[model samples]
Target: MKRIVFFLGKGGVGKTTSSAALSFYLSRNKKTTYWVSIDPAHNLSDIVHKDLHIKTQIDDFLFAEEVDVEGYLKNFLHETTNRMKEMYKYLQIVNLENMFDLLKHSPGMEEYALMYAMKEKIEENQDFEYIIVDTPPTGLMLKILSLPFSSKMWIEKLIRWRKRIISHRAAIANINPKKIDESLALTEEDDKVLKELGYQSEYVTFLIDLLSDKSKCKMVVVLNEDAMSLSESLKIKSGLNDLGLGLDFVILNKEGLGTVSNNIEKIFDLPTIRMPYLKNAMDTNTLANMGQRLAKIVE
Candidate 1:
């Protein structure tokens, strides 16, 4: 299973920078790694100073495009609508098309589609040792990670219902062979895809371990050295612990002016990575240097 390390925090923090830096370091160390951007306003290309639409091989590792969530949602809706049409035709119903259209607009669609895409990527890419995720802001980040468990529960219930329907139809199949043929044909295809979703534990556990693993995978929270950022860091720590995940470290970005305080030290036990305030935003060379610095911190 691939490890997924997330660089997450509030907006304007150094999450994207840290993600690019970590990916650079991992790749430099000869790991076949991938850094995926889940942030809508993606800046991985800016940090890398190259377009990542195609896989760019840097040193021993490769970087690929961020998951296009809208594309995933479109694909998912098309497949699901096709399946619904097949079922409606089998049952000789035309009125359900409106219902199907409404179903496409339901809540949680984006999250579900993203989870499906992530699962597909993990299953397909066996060569990569690590999949570094540059997640969105804190609230949305938690929702994305929690999706697998929620989706798994929903899938299990649907599987049970499908089994029950199959059994119920089996009794009537002998009496109505033509109807049974159409019904079974449609359901068989659905079962094939649904079965693939059934075996999603590997992907889910990969994420769980990434969140929980202190040694190999770490959740590095980036924050400014201000009262609000410090408070948010405490909240993030509590939330991660509530979810059975541990914070590997807290990075105080742009904290050059502050003298070290006892209160800040007491709030967090893990080693802190302090980055000085830069007059200008980072360029590729600067980001690469930051990557080297982060490598030392992890080491």
Candidate 2:
């Protein structure tokens, strides 16, 4: 079985560093690990001191990659357009140049794009024993994490609408076939699209089950000693709980550097780990050390 782990926190809380460190530690321990950076503003390369835009093999057991969001988005849009054309014969003449532009501004487009990339990577990386993701900040990560449930709900509504359309089409055909435009008639492609949507929804549901399963998935929330970070972490914990996924643990980074207290354990009700503040710049050596600390908790 594949184990997938995520490191998420507020921006500037050292999530990338922690993720890289933990991945390094895991890989060193004979686990076939792949470290993935999914943040739009990626810093995994900088942390690992390697060019991992596509992927880089660190060793026989370790691989790393930073997803190119723009490249993935373009491919996603192209695939979507192709699917649309396949579903609608009239789409051959329709101009979608503006549709692509509109999608860039659409709400949740980035999150969906990120989710698509994640799903693809997970599917392609079945050979790896461990998959570790360095996610974006708290808010966006929440949206991406909730995609399985939200997308399933959306697909369910679409399926219902498609059934209604089919019913109306049957009624119109019985009344007068000429009254309904041939182009407006539901085609085999429409049914195919609905079937595809249902199929994808099932896959998403499986993903949700796997994620909520503690043995297969571990979600660690990284935070610092601050009220804002604490508040965000609380919200994240609540959100994951709502989705039936537990917040596995919390890592308090930069301990003893600030006046912020570590009384968060009482409120969050989860095991808390702490990393001391590193005065020097973080390189592979320091990261490995950090990873050693994280490794203890996971073990």
Candidate 3:
């Protein structure tokens, strides 16, 4: 089983920073790890100050990639559209190009595409010991995390609807010899795709198990000392509990004066870690130092 860790919280709360530091530290221990950026506004390359997109191998044990969702979706749409065109010939439809364009513009398309890519990576990179995902901000993170369930439900509904439509079409075709077999064929093809989606959703159970496994997988929620962030973190913790996922720790980043010292004892009931605010901006050296500090928490 792969150990998957996600650094998630609101934007500008240092999730990217924590993710980079943790990935770096984990790599040092000779674990094969891939640090992935699932955020649209990717700063992973900026933080490392290197172009690490498209499966760049930084070291023997470490790799990184910034998922290009649009690029992936374009390729996926092209293939799907071609298949649609081929199948539509049976329905005697003059063109299916417009439908392809409409599908591209459909709601939740991007999310579904990205989830498909994630599922692909998990299967393709079986050699890696750990996969560290740097997710988008809170709301998007929630959507992405719950995608498997949503996608499954949507696909099932589509399948049922398509089956009903095909049955109706077949009845119409029996009376009128011009019965376009294309619509039924297209529905069958879509059913196959949805079947794959259902299988992938089931496969995601491994990821969920890895996340909920207290000893193997850990979720570290990074936040600041502000009240809003703290409250959000608490809600996130509760949400994870509702999903049957356990949060191993809450890391309070860039702690200000009196906050860590005063609140540290109170928060100690929860497995909490803190890092002091640095005067200068972060660099690789600074991140490595922060990683050292975090290692103590893990120890």
Candidate 4:
């Protein structure tokens, strides 16, 4: 029942529209749903025609929000720097504010911040029947999605090293009781660093399990009718496959195949959901109709 759907694709591929329509469909069916736009560009508010800059009730069961990705990123860095400073007293004289500025642009910062925000969201919002994520463009989103797996390995290694450090200290203390540093942990139980690494390992494991559980989580690729989009979509699939996660389906947004269906099926070897070109202006009714069409896939 972990209905978390991530709509991903190249930039300008209508990911927001596709995810929004699905939210409309599910909400109308009385399913408790949260439609979130994690894209930093913040198009969900304009697309949904509501002030979703804040989490807003769209209906009896649906909630919408355009996550402040930049704000969240800043807060994420602040908290991280603070924690590191506390753990390593040597950092106190190192001009943390300047370091914070540089770290803001550091590699993997956005992905880690977004992942942390997602962890917080999942932990806090447990009642929803669905949490539809409208992700950023392909490259960054792929990194964000696969972050837990990479983080798991790093945390595990850190834990092992911390344990060794604790064991070494205990051995030294045993040999010379007077030589022990009371400030340092001689046992694993008293080591805050080790305990933190353990918590991180456990959290990453939870994310890995959640992401690999296909029934609970689904990944959909949205694309245009061009060969470029299709090519990028394939890379997305390969990335997820590398992570041992399956791609549920492909949404050929602005499907232009006409009577020439099954091309997507042949390419992706998966079910293809077509959303035809929107000749008419976009509105709530159009989205609702599109959502209605998408409802069958969920059933």
Q: Which ten residues in a row have the lowest lDDT in candidate 3?
A: 181-190
| Candidate 2 lDDT for residue 284 | 63
Q: In model 1, how large is the Cα lDDT of residue 183?
A: 37
The TM-score between candidate 4 and the true structure equals 0.92
Q: Which stretches of candidate 4 lie over 4 Å from their true place?
A: 90-99, 257-262
- Show where candidate 3 strays beyond 4 Å: 86-89, 93-95, 157-216, 257-269, 279-281, 293-299
> To one decimal, what is the Cα RMSD in angstroms of model 2 from the true structure?
2.6
Name the lDDT value of residue 260 in candidate 4: 38
**Winner by TM-score:** 4
The Cα error of candidate 1 at residue 212, in Å, is 5.6
Which regions of candidate 2 fall more than 4 Å away from where they truly are?
A: 91-97, 180-190, 279-281, 296-298
Of 1 and 3, which scores higher on lDDT?
Answer: 3
Worst lDDT 10-window in candidate 1: 185-194
The candidate 2 region of ten consecutive residues with least summed lDDT is 181-190
Candidate 1 stretches with Cα past 4 Å from truth are 1-3, 58-64, 94-104, 122-126, 168-216, 257-262, 296-299
For candidate 4, write residues 1-299 as lDDT tens digits. Answer: 45888899999888988988898878877899998887888788886678887789977778998888888998988877787666665445677667687888899898898888777776566678888889999999999889999999889888888889889889999999778756777888888788778878887887888788777788999988887788899999999999999788898888764443458899899988889888652576678778876664565
Sliding window of 10 residues with minimal summed lDDT for model 4: 255-264
